[model samples]
Target chain A: MKRIFASAHVKRLFSALAALAILELMTGPPGSALTPTAGFTGSFGEASSFFGIFRTQRWVVFLFLALAMYAIWSAWLMWGTQVRAATAKAVSVPRAASRTRPVRWGMAVAVLAVALLLPHLITDPFWQAAMVEQIAVYVLLALGLNVVVGFAGLLDLGFVAFYAIGAYTTAWVTGALPTAAPFGIHFNNFYAIPIAIALAMGSGIILGAPTLRLRGDYLAIVTLGFGEIITIFANNLYGITGGSQGTNTIPHFSLHVGPIKYLWGLTPVPYYYLTIVFVILFIAGFKLLEHSRVGRAWTAIREDEVAAESVGINPLKYKVMAFAIGASTAGFAGVVTASQSNTIFPSSFTLQFSINILVLVIFGGMGSITGVVLGAIVIQTGSMYLLHTPPAGYQPQDLYIYLGALLVVMMIFRPAGLVPSRRRHREIGLAEKGEGHMNEVLTGDTP
Target chain B: MSDKIFDVDHVTLRFGGVVSLNDVTLHQERGEILAVIGPNGAGKTSLFNSLTGVYQPQEGTITFQGSDAKPMSVIGKKPHRVSAAGVARTFQASRMFSALTAFENIKIGAESHRGIGVAGAMLRGPKTRRDERTSDARTVELLDFVGLRAKANVISSSLSYGDRRRLEIARGLATGPQVLLLDEPAAGTNPSEKLELTTLIRKVRDEMGVSILLIEHDMKLVMSLAERLYVLNFGSVIAQGTPEEIRANEKVIEAYLGSTATETGDRS
Candidate 1:
């Protein structure tokens, strides 16, 4: 084989051919039979299911795709350094230019101004609703989960359970659930905020107190079980949760404090404005927390628990704090979502929802507030767009397949994420250079 | 009221069938450098763990009395509580927050004292800002004390082995403990680094007035630095005296120093 393909060009050709064959096998027509009765007969000469409009053979379609893939792969191999250098220069130039305090402040204000004016720019009712419902809500979720997974390095797979708790708590307080409101107050959703937050935080502490002692995979498993338990209870507890039917009597928010008598109606734009205001407030608070003593304690705990304890930081206390704090944000998001939507089903808080928020956090650069916000907006918008106008052969079920493929590619190229925090980016870089363990970087393991 | 920083007696620790520490008794005085030397599996690290509340003794009393504070029982308390009681320890292996900057690693220890609550942290009131400034100053001072001020911004994982040991010491000092535990501080350093470490240890005692409890396999460094020495063999304290007394004791030589000519000879 060496003698036959001694030249690099010939070697490349052989590898390309092998890749094309594998691609053809995967995307081509299925086998005729599973048993030997039909001799496993199949042919790649069949018309492609994807290119049905063109009536093209499966191999022909796969061949084009394989070639395109090979082209990109080979080009990357040939010019990866130059591409990286060019991007570094492009990014660093702007960063260095904007390093001044005034310049940075100006840029931040510009971004905020654009964010505030977004609803006005998009007049379409469908897009506006999608903005508030999908983008804003998930942004809140990603931010909350980021604290648990990113800052504290705790893998909480049941994060959505807190969101569910928050929503249910709001329902109970607003007299929407089958159960009577506490104190029989039957207050507005705005009044339910503190109660929902407190409930969510209380549950966070309850769950975290026992389970936070388990490290890594064990903790993840316990949290996963907790999420499933919450969902099952929500589905089965008909008297309290209204079961699968859920509740729809939740009223929209209204302000009646001292002549500020504004009502939030069915228009999604008003809700979007409210959500953004809270998002801004949260971002400010989280940003402050990130650079504070609490943040350092979290970082120390995440990095080395024993060392953190040796420095007088109780690891369990900080881990629980991360959970409760993260949960409170989710609870607040739940209040917003529940009041805005009018009805929320147990089906809405699935394990997949938690994973989806996790994906957003990881995709955006787990510890970066701005990164997750951008990630949520881009991903949620993209998914909503697909639902609105899916292309040919793009089944709704196939979204995850595409998303999975994207994540795989992302992990390979940018393991630290698109907008990773400085420490995370450095950690991944060091791990790549073999100076640190990759498991520590990826899974937050001590090793 | 006791002048001793630590008063440990009859500490017996066992894991399953094996007794890791067998009725070990030891004491450390105020502003003194104490060394605990033993061969591998001599329960030196186990004793440190017990002192730090990582492990609980089946039968013992561990009391910590810093210069100003009342003597408090160490057993049954959490590690952080023991730490807050003015005891800080380094690890046998250099455990640093690898991804963080060198300054940040030490700052974590410095700011761990009198932590601003979550609300204050999120709000960034004037008090929080003042605390942060003071923490940064202390962190810088400690880094300079350890001769690592130049490497403040560097990621801790990329530090040299000698530098890592120094960083760990700086981190421990950053906690502002009255008693500092040094676990194999000179294990992986070169000869020149060892000399520097010895000087630094002495400076920590003389200048900072912090008592030192060290576990070391390096006989030469331990003999030169430690005022008092405790020898352990098979999980129990075999001998305890001044270094000169320990150097002459028959049991110490038979248990530890005699084997030193062959195994770990290069280390000394």
Candidate 2:
């Protein structure tokens, strides 16, 4: 059945069209197309009059949510198979290789792409504001960590430390310190973001330095310690930090582009665009670095440090750099983190946060940015919507069941990552190194 | 051994009160095959360890390539650094990356020449991938040269005993080291395989342009492969000379002949 999809020319053509549509939506088609929306903005797309029936509204929301899932799934489909195609052809293409993949992809893109695009047909600001913000923040945070773990291969147990660092940097530096009236400093997220990045990197270096020599388990332990320390400090430091009570009335992101305050005025829309733009920038930076020499350096370190060092690679230095870079992503994440909420507590930077990022890396495939981006969306948003938002009467362990099942299935079937690194897919087999495969795709390949 | 390709001048090694090696000095020429034949605790492997920097000497210096320059004193140097300095060794048990395939293993072994780095490997685009391709081809070539081409894609653990030994040699040679150290080439092989090993060692010495310091217990194999031999009875060398000369030495006779020929086979 699956073979017919690849063997038949007509089916292949349909797949190619679907592939284009998927890429158009997934790659965003150079921004000329109308912006695709999901969640709330998408939820109200079909309704023209003031109010609609509960069923219609519910259906609209469901359609948009499905589209959102499609948007993420399409990217994974396109890049995932594309990489497999590239690698399978490395030695020779087996005629028995997967064939029905394209048909299924076509079916997926045809159904969902229309649903997502439907929202753009409307000009409702509220839904537009909601859907876009959701996608943008996710892409940004995921991409930041993509560089840290995907490219470098350092397993960070305390990535949320940096995320918290970014958030608090915005919170502390921009907002009042509760006793800042005497100091006379105005709150500004503009200054806070960069400072947050710097501070996160500084702390990243500190955390990275001592544990760089240790591999796997030991590195995980030290980073876990660093994360706990950050959370404790945030909790204990009452004078500077708000402590367990949390901070309030924090500012939002504001920037002026050539005398124009492009994304200003505390609104979700501007923050949405602001986040998307930064996500683009992070993606670009990560892409360039992955394709650059540094990306290869990281992969080699991951594969075999001893072998890498024997070939003149300075393992300690590169390992440390990986830790710092990965931490920096968390830091950047923090900046947006603080801004978006305008309030934060140490609870936000819990060990679970660290686990979430690690899960992102694992699911996405270690060493693959595209995989991480896909993983962050599907896992984070999926978990939030599915497990966290049940049809009422949700068990506390509902989230665990969904995540655990997917994780168990993924691990048993595809341990490398949902989307894996390119070279590792061939090197370590699919399940062990899929996430890493995507990273390799993003970075190119070091050794 | 020819006149001094490696010169160990009274080099000694100690692990606390125990002396693993003591005042061992030996040399192998650029093209000759040398063997260190001894019983289990004769410090043959330890000699290779010192030369390759697995264990630093407690005292004394060693030199390579006929220079007055201070001996490289491999004693405290890291294993890889010592390898990069033109010495490569195999373990008593095959020390290899079990996860890596034969081709990948050799490619890793050839990493020294491929200019492979994390950055290069990460990019894995044209320049870096081309490097991988060329090196992989070279790895296949070396594997074929060592007659393990059929097992190139197989995991290191899955290979047969003879194939594993060949893979180890292939990995050692991938470094393109000036000298190759084989701990025991024929220790566990059948008689026919041992004979085949003799031809292979000679072929490696002749073809690879790498000298060899072999440690083995098979007197017949050792006497044939090694042009000159060093016989270690206890912790020190009992005799160092041509196989014929060592064969006729009194210490060699006392160590083996005095032990009674029947007991020698039982102990071995």
lDDT of 2 at A276: 57
Deviation in Å, model 1, residue A281 alpha carbon: 1.0
Predicted complexes: DockQ each:
0.67, 0.13
Clashing pairs in 1: none
Best by TM-score: 1
lDDT of 1 by residue, A1-447 (tens): 778779766677667767666545433333345532211122333255444554654455555666776687678879989998999988997889888889988988999899889989998888999999999988998999989888888898999999998888888998999898988888988878899899999999999999998888888899999999999999999999999989998889988889788889669989998988989888999999888888878877776788889989988889999999999999999998999988989999999998999999988987888889888888899999988876533458767865776688689888878788887787678766766432352464754
- Cα deviation at A158, candidate 1, in Å, is 0.9
Question: Candidate 1 lDDT, tens digit per residue, B89-137?
Answer: 8888888888888999999989887954899989998898899899999
Q: Candidate 2's residue-wise lDDT over A391-424, tens digit each?
A: 3223445565456657776877786788876644
lDDT of 1 at A231: 93
Fnat score for model 2: 0.06
lDDT of 2 at B17: 92
Computed on C-alpha atoms, the DockQ of candidate 2 is 0.13
